[model samples]
Target: MLNSCKLQSRNGSKPIVKQASFLTHANILLRCHRQAASRLGRCACIRAKLEQAEVATQKTKDEVVVERVSSTGGSRKAFAKAFTAILGLKLAKPEDLDPETLLNPPFPRYQVPGSDLAVQKLRPYFFNRTYTDTDVGYLAFFAAMHLVAVIGGPLTFSWEALEVCLAGYVLTGMLGISVSYHRQLSHKSFRCVKPLEYFLAYCGALAFEGDPVEWSKMHRWHHMHSDTTADRHSPRDGVWHSHMGWLFDESLNSTRRDANGNMKDSLSPPWFYKESPEFYSWLRATYMYHQIGQAAFFFALGGVPYLVWGFVIRVLLTMHMTWLVNSAVHIWGEQRYVSNDNSRNNWIVGLLVFGDGGFGVKLRIICQCRQHIPRHHNNHHAFEYSAAHGLEWWEIDMSYYFIRGLELLGLAWDVRRPSPSQLVAKRIPPSPSAGASR
Candidate 1:
């Protein structure tokens, strides 16, 4: 929102400091003269000039404040002052100012309290679409991929191609997206050596969800501001908005841009950026090209069948599953524990997402495959870094099994967990079958 004001200035022969001083004395004189002069005479002579001088002083003060701010690399506090001073009038002290003026103004903009950026944190206007050219390009790509997947997936159906599709799904969807992107990168749920870690992250990049760094930062932001206006994929924005609307919405991108532009004054610690290795950062920066190369390789190897199944179908399926966690899981299923956001556990979504299959007849046989993620997903929201999303005998998380298998092989280590006692302390309700199983 912008505020426009017009103020007339005098072509003064004196320095601003001297003019300000003269005006200050003139205001005092005007006040004294008002008592003696008739009301009509008093109004005619000095009222207009008095108001103009006051505007000039306020403008000069505003300029000095903004100069101080710009010299120091800028800050939210500095910008807030500049925003008010330049665009609108500041209210006087509580004793003198009208309460209404303080309550609201013709145009209002503010910096989010405690945010470090100098950019005004204007409230989100959901209807005011802010899509950029990049977002439109992504939409175009999505449409093209879907069209190919629909037409080619049927025409090129074969046992060999189906096998390829299922293998790629398990590798890219389960290990790449679920384990690498959601668990390791998003939550730091476990630690692995850099070589293995980056390799898995590369697999995630092949999933075409976005780059590793972008995924990690967005997830962190989601957790930090879940369900609020700042949350990138809050279900509160409606099912479509939470599921995929946020991907194209400029709200998330704008926040990230502001963060980068104001890093010097950012309140977020340096460790957030330093957590990822240089190689991973480089991959993330150029990940679009990497994905294009993957598509080209698939095309060269097996033609349209390979391209459709490997790139198009794989990406489409992975996107839906990932979106389910943000949308269906929040809207359906029971909330097991008190949480800050409306995250839930939908068994149907979990079964489809975390299950694995290598060879299935026409690939539809694996559609009903089960995974234990939904049984313990609430624990993920409660204990973010815990490797145990399902920390019980009946709660069977296939992803956890894979992580454990890797730990036993010494390929992955430092598997973080919250003890059963901690779960009880968090007031997590025990399952009805808990005692019977024990």
Candidate 2:
């Protein structure tokens, strides 16, 4: 089922394809025809063949007229906005997409669950939210930090302390986001030792992005819905909307939380957080225990500095940089190889994000951008939920490295890699410095 988390307007560009009526024609099996025809229809797994088609326009016979107008002109700006908004909701050329073709994309191998399922409809909005004290507390925390950056400075305490905290933040970005959240929590890319897995998730919870299950669901949805109305965060969509828009929206988060937050039955084995009730229980207790621990530390320290830096400032920094992975990576970056939409292998953000949040692990040894999931991210928008993002020898994947280490120790298994043929097919030009690591 394609969950509609809803959308709203801001001052940025509108999504390229809006009405997305074509979305309605997908998974004919899941349409009103099926749902209305039967009270309870069962959809079981079965192999179905689909066709693949691509249109190449080399000569560029058709030309889209370009109108140059004053940047500050209201009508010119309004015209641009109106045109994109209309196209967003209108039907796209079937030639632009073959929804059926999505059943299989360029990954050649290793697809995530639900990647091949057809989406039949789209809702224009999400729901309402009931926030808690914790929500309010964090909201204020973020507001304060934003004010400080605007008024004071970065609130620099000490380089030594900042660097340590920065390294820890980098860990949260790399180990926490890549290992815990993206690969492990989101895609189940590999397995991990129990104690380490639980401990890592506990830290990720501190990052407070949201519950891991909810994050995974939306992310899985993002892969399935990339570059379309379905994508929760695509640069092709409105910039801010694709950036921090949905994450901060009460309705969207609330709807996602309701679906995924309390789901223990949703787990797939060896996927402990979803599979093992014990793991879930342990993490819940750990979450509560962490709060108590923070309070206790504040008691022991008896100072505002710890509360501000260790708690508030720390959380704020982690939250946005994690968001930067989704936003910054899409907007600014050097594309080692283009797949589709707008996903670049950002160098500064990679180092800033501590080696593509570990996605560039083994592949990082090659190019540091390929490897791991979201492979051929350009391709990902063109092909969602591809487990192997790197189709070339140079793309480094940091998360894969950790997973590989665990596999060597007999603590992890089922590490998924793109087939050798896929690598040979893309055949990205070789980088002279492929096996370098940061």
- Top-TM-score candidate index: 1
State the lDDT of candidate 1 residue by residue for 326-413, as single tens digits.
Answer: 7666666655665677666556776777721111122224454333233445556767787767655555577778888889989888
lDDT of 1 at 427: 54
Candidate 2: C-alpha RMSD after superposition: 26.3
Q: What's model 1's TM-score?
A: 0.62
- For 280-331, candidate 2 gives per-residue lDDT tens digits of 5444434534544664574366344444455555556777666666766666
Provide the TM-score for each candidate, comma-separated: 0.62, 0.53
lDDT of each: 0.62, 0.48
How close to the true structure is residue 279 of candidate 2, measured as C-alpha lDDT?
A: 57
Off by over 4 Å in 2: 1-141, 148-156, 251-271, 281-292, 295-306, 334-341, 357-396, 426-438
Candidate No. with top lDDT: 1
